[model samples]
Target: MSNVEIRPVTPADHSVWLQLWQAYLHFYDTELPAETSALAWQRFLDPTEPTHATLAWRGNQAIGLGQWIFHRSNWTVSHNCYLQDLFVQPDVRCGGVGRQLIEHVLTQARNAGSTNVHWLTQATNHTAMRLYDQMAKRSGFVQYRHAL
Candidate 1:
């Protein structure tokens, strides 16, 4: 983790970012439309958009990714940051890369005056939960969503 560098995604990062993005989706057994993914990439590169993305690199190889969005919340006057996605190469799991990526998002949210940062994970993702437990308290809120 000490040697890893976490930075905002750039146009030059498209190929590597797409590789990690696909892997992240596959990990959750989810499949999104290609156009949706393309749109997301475009949004990440748009400065005016609230969506943002970051990649963790070890040398020239990308090992992890963090994507977040900032938006208004009724719960507070300050903006809230939603950590929409987080992923690390399977081989690099538990080696602090994930933590570094999370910390990077947290720092960004703080700098932007966001009140808090939140994210979701499947209940079966116990390994990631172990690390998450150390970084944040459980909110005790269940999520219910209906697709349009």
Candidate 2:
């Protein structure tokens, strides 16, 4: 945890990012189509897109991934940052990697003049919620989605 560096993704980071990305999806017991994942990678690299990604590295190995987006919000004049995904390698969990990743996103959001940063986690993700509770206030709103 001491030497961990958080940096934005680059073209050469695809392999390691993909590995972490898939691991993240597996952690949620979900799988995305290859094309969907590839498209997301492309969007992360596209400057025109609001999507972005960063990786946490310990020495030469990637230990975590953070992906976020900036978008206009109805409640604020400035754009808001949505931390869409966060994942730390299982072996490195609870070693401050996840916190560091969230901090990285927060810094980036601030730099971009976003009003705030927000994210979602499953109700059962108590371990992560503990960390999140320390870092942010609970909005007390429930999320609902309608699948097409």
Candidate 3:
């Protein structure tokens, strides 16, 4: 939509960012320590940090957020961009906000000379998988994690 704009998050965006961040976590039926969220917000503001964030805005209202990090990959000489989080407002789902936020990250990764941009979503999140399937190919690798 012409009215929608996506931009990097700024320090002044703390309040609005928190709202969207909370909504994102809730959508996944998860919760984090407040301090973890606080640290994430701080990371976005820290120039030296590899973590970055972008927000989708319709006029002055923040409608979505995309958080990503750049890291070295042994498979590639260039860094890989991992899109760690993405969320669109429930009221604004399917209105192209999510797509735009993802595209924003792709552009960022490209500009930063990243070899690829990748992320994982729950297999049950079929709605988002539809969009992702259209945009990128599946890696076909199952994920396994051992929580510390």
Candidate 4:
């Protein structure tokens, strides 16, 4: 595997970011409305928005993507980082891109003075779980959602 360069998304990265983002949505068998996707991309570029995204590049090719948001936590005075999305190209899995993307988020969270960096995945996402197991402790809390 070649060296992977992970960096925050810039307007010039829109095309590559969309490719990775679409692949991520496909992996979960999900789809978002075109408007929603556009909004998300715009939010990532908005400095006032707490949402952000990063891409892992191998040479000129983008191989992974990560999206996170910062928010206040009732339990702490500092901000908390929620890693909302993570995906690595199928051919590059297990080659360290995913971990690098995650570490990028952690570093950003730390620099922002966030209390913690956290994420969630379905129980069936075994491959990612393996790496995650080595990176952080499980919070042991079940998530309950009330969607509008």
Show where candidate 3 strays beyond 4 Å: none
Model 1: per-residue lDDT, tens digit, 1-148? 6999999999999999999999999999999999999999999999999999999999999999999999999989999999999999999999999999999999999999999999999999999999999999999999999989
Q: In candidate 1, list every pair of residues with a backbone clash.
A: none
Best by TM-score: 1
Query: Clashes in model 3: which pairs?
Result: none
TM accuracy, model 4 = 0.97
Ranking by lDDT: 1, 2, 4, 3
- lDDT (tens digit, per residue) of candidate 4 on 2-118: 488999899999999999999999999999998999999999999999999999999999999999999999999999999999999999899998899999999999999999999
Native-vs-model 2 lDDT? Answer: 0.96
Against the unseen true structure, what C-alpha lDDT does each candidate score?
0.98, 0.96, 0.94, 0.95
Alpha carbon lDDT at 137, candidate 3: 94
Q: Which ranges of candidate 2 are over 4 A from the true structure?
A: none
> What are the clashing pairs of model 2?
none
Worst 10 residues of 1 by lDDT: 1-10
In terms of lDDT, the poorest run of 10 residues in model 2 is 86-95
Model 2 C-alpha lDDT per residue in residues 63-144, reported as the tens digit of each score:
9999999999999999999999999998888999999999999999999999999999999999899999999999999999
Q: Model 3: per-residue lDDT, tens digit, 1-148?
A: 6689999999889999999999888988999999999999999999999999999999999999999999999999999999999999988888888899999999999999999999999999998999999999999999999999
Best by lDDT: 1
Residue pairs whose backbone atoms clash in candidate 4: none
